[model samples]
Target: MNPLLCGLAANPALPPELVDRLLTLALEEARADPASQFADDLLHGLADRADLRHDQILELAAHSDTMARYLAYGGTLDAADVDPGSMPNAAVALLDERRGNLAWARFLATHPDPQIRWKLASCPGLPQDAVDLLAADPDEEVVKELALWTDSPVTARLALHPDPEVRIAAAANPSTPLEAVIVLAADPELTLKWTLSERTDLPQALYARLAADPHAGVRATYASNPGIGQELIRVLAADPELQVRRAVAKHPRIPLDLLAELVVGDRAGWNLLPRIAAATPAELKEPAGSRHAAVRMLVAQRRDLPPHLREALAVDPDASVVRAVAPHPGLSEELLRAMVARHGVQVLAAVAANPDASGPLLEYLTQHRPGVRRVLKEVAEHPHATGPALLACLADRTSRPLAAAHPALPPEAITELLADEDHQVAEAAAGNPSLPRAVMLELMP
Candidate 1:
């Protein structure tokens, strides 16, 4: 490379092509002596030349280190060089350089293509004056982009737009002014009215009003949003549309009482409610003894079941409910045993953790069943549960824990068993670990 050519390559104002070839030569030789620029200057010149195909120009631009290219650009790129398709890419580069100048941006704002115009309007660098002009643009596409605006007046104008699509777009915009969304709730079009149902963007006042909207869809749309009022949820739970009803059934906001309505009686006779009812917590249940096996089945899984619910469900005719109630945490030990006679020891596991289980049941658990004993042992050692019911079992002499239980209990029951003394009592305590450690140690020798 000639010394003059080399020096010219370093010149910031040199024609882009010669600078590019010189940069390539410098990079090819690994000339770190202020010469190995990531891209030759000519490629940037090619990128700026508008007559070249965009892809070809991009191909050249892609070679330059992005940071280095912006450094090379040094605030000289005019609006003419900003291509419509490539406008975002170049604008991003310019913004990154903090070169959000009027000339570079003005070219983009007034670009012939709406795509470019929209992108520029959406850009954070778009001047407030430019945003005001673009927000009022008549094109729906331009109007829609204006909703991205954070300014209340600018976002509101588009939000108040007469077009349903534009209003829908505005309602969906995160920056849409709250006042603007309120205006749409008053729109007559079903779509705009329906847009009021969405809980995500609409204000609380607007969302509540929409829930009462006379249009079924508008009210139904409100039902779909979890933020809809609880009273409104009750109303929507009865919505005629199966789609709306189904949506309510799945919404966490829908009232439990309303869920019962939705979960019962087949509007279509097949009964979608049965599947839904099968998952309710026992605390939500109203039936002392629910008829549906699935509903009764769900009642068994609730940890918060009230005593009335537990007592009522304890005698359920369904063996599954009996089995479920047998191990219910809320059920008394005596109640658990009664349920067991109905559903058998297989059902006893349900109440194994019940703090109210009788010592006799614990004694029975230690004898023949490994699974039941394992559960009883966990109840004894589990951090959250106090195993007072296991006192008699832990005090017994011959008690033996089921082998290979998870969260194994410590060696301490023998002392509690020694204190127990009764033959049946001692045997039951041997398997239970909640027995007094000192009593077990004294009995060890």
Candidate 2:
């Protein structure tokens, strides 16, 4: 058998004689015809094997292919024998692949090429001294790479570096110490302050300070920061810039009274009422009787409101308010039925989807509102849905997917759904625990 063919077979246990013959032929051919495909194949095969002689290793390193050089030099080749300057970038990368190759690492550490220095910066096992040296590298790219090493002592130095780009990278690194971040926060560059404002651990004083920043963009960040307490929220709520005040309205921690004031007073007309309505029950009460229908609608959706207030909002003249109250868990049964009778199917759909919806109401909506697909789908999946209601939903092809998955679906309906033309329907049927043992077994891969 040809030695090259034997090597290509990848049989690690090939006889020693076969290995020696293959190496000899491959080296000779590679030297005579450097571009030979057969020689390249044999060289690659021998590159991964540990049986290469010292001369064979050197021969492979000197080969024209960079890949062949990387494979050869990646092994036990001495640093002196390998010329780092002449080697291609790819070959240089291969040397750093293995950890703790101190000789190669130290030689490449100062290897004039910035690309080599950049790669070294990412090595976790790189020595601290080498990291320090790279941190001060003239090239911003090299320094930027070092900025990512959060634990490096050099990150603090880079944070204050004259280059805004380097400072920005350091500021963004979560590992950069708080002291360094505070300095970056005050940096004249709006971009640096913007990056620093995103840090969750920003000091309360900083939040307050950034809130009054000359630039709307910086104050906007402060407005959006959840850590901003009521004091900062109050300040931002009254900001001259409508955009900043709008951001305060969306803030999760803004005082309820302040949000109400913004809803009623801010002339920006940004539609901040929905967010205020979503506030905790305690907050919702602050804006309970605001003239804005949007604000009133949100207040009506709160479950914590007193019965009188909820009942009054439920019967409010505004259809949107009535619709909002329809989904409130604390909504009275009388009010829900009244809303369903008075409002259109849109309001009824919200009621049908509410977990607090009564069984009788769900049945009523299921029977009378079958034309609305959303309402029917919600009714089909309702925990209180009646047997007849689920059957009605299953009968409609549009609502079958949701109906087929309902626990109330009968075994016969499930069997019928198993053969549904819609794959989603069939898949839902397969996953239903009520499916027969034989049916489940058939669904197995």
Candidate 3:
């Protein structure tokens, strides 16, 4: 099919009469040359569109094309009255629909090919009779596939399968009986224990056992579980493994007091303070007073920091803290402008990217730092950027793609951009609403 016709067929807003005309043309082409793949493809593509009127879908469904009829029936063998036994492709499509047709599912369950049964095994809506038959299939892969489903009638039996891989898949299914879960939890296979450790819905005793697992990896995964209790968090916080402790530090439920204790050292403070969700005024003071520049820099990155802390960090002796807080929206305009005047490129780029930077500040930053990509792209895309700054950005290769889409670009600049060497630049220019209506129609495919 021509790209234009394909685009039109996919457009839901295409008037019904136009769709009818396209379908009529395609069918006429198919009749004259039965081997015409484009006509067949167009017919097949339109068969599954839910937006098509019933009459249009009927035309596709009644066509001689088997694939079109198959697609129209929504992948149901019985719905199309195509022989269920005749086509392996039909069976694959039918299984995908997961229509939960018991007879067809049962028929496919024992089909000579194990691959069909393997596909059937993963269907979430498989009937119990089909599940029962497939679960006992001699083909290990089919049984292994069936073991993945929580609703599989035979999950209990599959849990004890001789293959640990099969048992591991069964362990992931919540419906696997508790006795089997306990067995898998203690099983020598570390992967099975690791998988089971991540599931919080398991009984607390099982979680506790997994938390104390000899392997630190299993304990870390358990520590990160959202549903683990405060008591477990406390235990994990003291664990000798730094990863286990780090996981506790990041847990959403980690107590503020525990977090305070964890940040006693400079290394811990640098890693943990920025992640604390809540902090008291006293907690803020400790980090603010820390001797290490890195510790203070971490505190400066906190979004919930108080205005006083922000103001103090904006002028911090260390350049890192100052740069960290430059983009903070809470900084006063006067303070921001002072930083702009005093600081170099890093601070200038940060200020330009700040959402609260005023239009005048952005325009000045854009004109001064047009070569700095951070400033150019940020200012070009900023809603507050003026026509002159956008036009400057359009002149630079680094920012042209973003600048082309800016509504401030004059009609002539946008038109020039519409044919720029970069396809993305041209595409962005084509979408600019500032493009004259006459120019827009001329660029249409």
Candidate 4:
């Protein structure tokens, strides 16, 4: 057998007729010279393939070689006469296929190795006796694995198990009995409520109970459930806990009025505007001009604001609103220049990072704000940054790392940065992707 034939046999693009010819030649060569390593290698390569025809696999299984039979079986024992002991791989393969006689399942269920028994426990549709044996296995993990199976006949028993982890897995299984759902719903374990709240199939009584669960985590989790009706949303929206209200505000079905109401009076709290799906311009106009800077900050974060609104928010008296609107794509060139002039250091970095900021605006920042290292760093990293601005950033130590990663950096500059004392600078230069092929070759170990 040609040693090169081993690789040719495994090529997926090889025609079926050629593959068959190669297999026949390998078999003939193997039988003629049993100790030929090249023959054995070809046979092993053919036998290990998943795409082989059923007839080809059977041919390999009938051969005298043991590993060839193991690979041909491909983790399935559909063959009528498999001697597992003679083919050691069959022992693990049997459970992977989940196909075997009741006797085999019984034997594996009681195997001394907990890992073996654990694997058997997760197999779907196991015989009742085997399931019973695994349910009583000494290893908690084996029992937990059994609990995770939705079709497990012993779900009711596993749900009431002493260990909370086992019960949690059982509760997560959708096939768990309704009676078990009631028990786990009221289970003192706080974590169980958190898990049960995410389940949409639970009875309404359980949903109601979870909505008002004493623990804020449970209420918050329940509030986020999509199946919860508008009434529950209303209930959670009024809950004393801020986190629960926040979760309710995020529901896609939440009433626009309710979402608009939640956005108010949260001065230092979360920005609910972006997360609220139904927040329209009409709904937000009032909050956009509210006395509270926090509410205005949320409005500024919205990307849908009209040009006038974006311009108004860009120059908001509050620094928070200015910061939020600086990166917004809607701001005009004149507005961007005005923002940079009005709020020099405060908004410079944010303006530099804006994707919509023009190349000339970036150059202006590079020329006028040369002393602001953070602004220079943001400009160096900005995709819209001009070539001259990038070169200027390359000269500044603070901006050099980001400048090295910029595609506009000259090849000579990138190559020199590769050997800089700072490894970060060298790494950034190497990752530029457009580095000359010669430079990349030098980087190879």
Candidate 5:
């Protein structure tokens, strides 16, 4: 009988003679017929035994390592009829490559071999019952892997784990149940709260509570929050670590009223601002031109910067501050123009959309071509320019009605805008200032 014909033979099951045929096919395949060694014939012969008793299947498993290995390698275990006798050992191999059935996997999920259990935890159809059973596995490696796999909804169940490492492991899962993680954040164990607070989406309320946690590490997370609550911030400010203190100093949300206090020291613990020649409001108006670029850069980003602060930045030693002021909403046209003239196109592009920008700024955009309708709107908003000048820009075919229904545009400015040919521009104008009287007459047609 052709060996290839063995699969469709009268006795399809692993009839004893079929093994001898498969072995012969393997030899024929070895000489250079790579296709003959294919496990299909062997797998078919093994799988054909639908009536094999569970013990008989396991007995077959013990008798021939070659057959067991073939079944494990091919991932075609149906012929085994029942879980193989060496299921745990077979599982260790298939689970590694992600190629086994749920029954094969669950058999060794609690197997004495840590390697076997770890691999099973990662199996795609790992049963929840298996997960629940292994939750108490002594190996931290096993516990940690399970934690990563257990979706957050189920992570809460593991929180009661007596091991702090396990609880913290559960906390590290991005999907850890919010309630469970939140409760863990207040856990008396310093490690638990400290670990939980590092998660960015943890509720602000929970973070604030951790800000004053007895453990310094727990408080570190709050220190890093640029937008920490003012009350929580006060607690972090008192933290002993200089690094934590620096984080507080750099936080964008700290009120200018408090920024004054950070003026004293540098990252090196020495007065670093002397180089920049600027200081927080308490020590000085702004950083000196030759001062630390970081301090000045930080000042440039400060939303609290007032007119005086901007003026101070106008001649800032580093072009960064002046560049920052070029786009600053708070700066006057006079100040913005000075910065743009000093720094050129890049800074000009940043605030090109400010409605308060001047005609000169609009004029600059024309020179640069980098200025789109976005820049024109800034010119329209500049306090010095007449409404007519801004209205003419609405005539821009490039980008019509830069700021539609913008509250800052005057009623007359809005009225004339209605005649704009561009539909979007005309719509913006029609919706503006109760519609232009001129438009009302024109639309009558």
Candidate 6:
């Protein structure tokens, strides 16, 4: 019943000593009960071990359990030893289970069952020769599975496949040559053109072609590519479609000056300020002082703001701006305390969550706001939480789970929390690294 042995047996790769230990345990279990599943699983693990002799593999395969026998035949048995006549179904199942085994793939290549051939087509790590054979499969579904193999030479053949769906998959594959991509871009189907527009590696010439595409959807897709040149970006910026312009505004490489203009001039672009705020910190100074509270609210959340900007936003007339700034670590102590006094409990909870809160400030919040349990949970999890603050959190049933997992919680309290009836409390206690080794052995499955 050792979980480590079961885990080791399930893994295909194992260190020599661990494999020896697993085999020893399996043999001991098999002595007591000859048909133990763990012994069979361990035998299967040994069958996959490259260090074992061919005869040892044969012995394990001969006595393996039904499931292990099937895997062994597919994985380790030579083609001559397999009786194709006696076990037709097992032969097919073996092929399905075999991964990257070239001999098995060759044997199954001509399997009359298209379904069996389909399995070979989808199996990963198969030899390139085997993949090339599967690509010409008469069944479209089997051919479709070949599309998933990006490195295979067959992917080039799949690009020219008559089936548009298969062609689309080939276009999306990273291995598809740039020449094939150009052909797909010119496909009469708008969907194929749109899919090609999303590829980041497309050359600048393709971007220009896609930018002027008659379909707005294709142009919009090109607008989102960060690699699109500035000239193409400006053209897309003036695109009549609001969606296309919005995509232009969000491009990471969009000129900062242009982004600032879009924020003020385009109504659709205003909603994208959060994204713009991340790239253009210096350009946002004017937007931070915007008369519109929504624009100011998004700017207040930017961590790159100077201390002076944080202080200014902290005292803004909008409560939302104050709430957004409350959790910022750089906010002045005077501003945090003033906001806590003027605003409601939610603002106090935010301040409590800020790791930079001084020990004196945490103490004041813990004592003065005894009834606010939400703030207590934040204080309990804060890295700066003191012993007294954590104790206050542990006393409340509503906040005890967060407190139980806090690294600052005393070792003795954690031991007590391990026995807590609440599943969440016990689960949190189990995850704490400081939990004694003996306790972890009992709690971890």
Of the candidates shown, which would achieve the greatest TM-score relative to the real structure?
3
- TM-score of every candidate relative to the true structure: 0.37, 0.54, 0.58, 0.58, 0.36, 0.55
Q: How many residue pairs clash in all the candidates, one count each? A: 26, 0, 0, 0, 16, 0
Show where candidate 5 strays beyond 4 Å.
1-223, 226-280, 283-294, 303-309, 327-335, 349-373, 380-392, 395-399, 403-423, 441-445
- The C-alpha local distance difference test score for the whole of candidate 5 amounts to 0.55
**Cα RMSD for candidate 5?**
23.2
Candidate 3 ranges beyond 4 A from true positions: 1-163, 170-180, 201-223, 227-248, 255-275, 278-293, 296-299, 302-312, 368-371, 395-398
**How many pairs in model 5 have backbone atoms within 3 A of each other, for residues 3 or more apart or on separate chains, i.e. clashes?**
16
Tens digit per residue, CA lDDT, model 2, 1-445: 2332422323344445655666677778777987887777666766676666677667667765375356634664554456655653434455455423444555666778787788776666566767777786778888887786546667788888888888888887767888998888777773655666656677889777767779997888778777777777887887898888878877876666666666665545343344554565555555667677766865765656667777788888778778777776777677788887787775878788777887778778877743577777888778887667787787667778777767667877876777777766775565454655554434322
Q: Per-residue lDDT for 1-445 in model 3, tens only?
A: 1433443444344456666777887788788888987687657655545567656655664565366337524742243443457554455455556543346788888889887788778777777888888878889888878887637648889888888778887887766787877777778863665767545577777777779988887788888776688888899899999878877767766775576566556264343343454566677787676776765776777766788888888887776667777778877778878776677665777777767887778778876642476788888888777778788777668788788877777879887876577766776676565766566445333
Model 1 TM: 0.37
- Where does the lowest 10-residue lDDT sum fall in candidate 4? 84-93
Write down the worst ten-residue block by lDDT for model 3. 75-84
Ranking by lDDT: 4, 3, 2, 6, 5, 1
Ranking by TM-score: 3, 4, 6, 2, 1, 5
Q: Judging by TM-score, tell me the better candidate of 1 and 6.
A: 6
Instruction: State which candidate, 1 or 2, has the greater TM-score.
Output: 2
Error of 4 at 190 (Å): 8.2
Cα lDDT of model 1 by residue, 347-422, tens digit: 6556555666654565565453434544555445433332343442343322222211111333353333333434
The CA lDDT of each predicted structure is 0.52, 0.68, 0.70, 0.73, 0.55, 0.67
Residue 341, candidate 5: Cα error in Å is 2.6
Best by lDDT: 4
Quick one: RMSD of model 2?
A: 15.6
For model 5, the run of ten residues with the poorest summed lDDT: 1-10
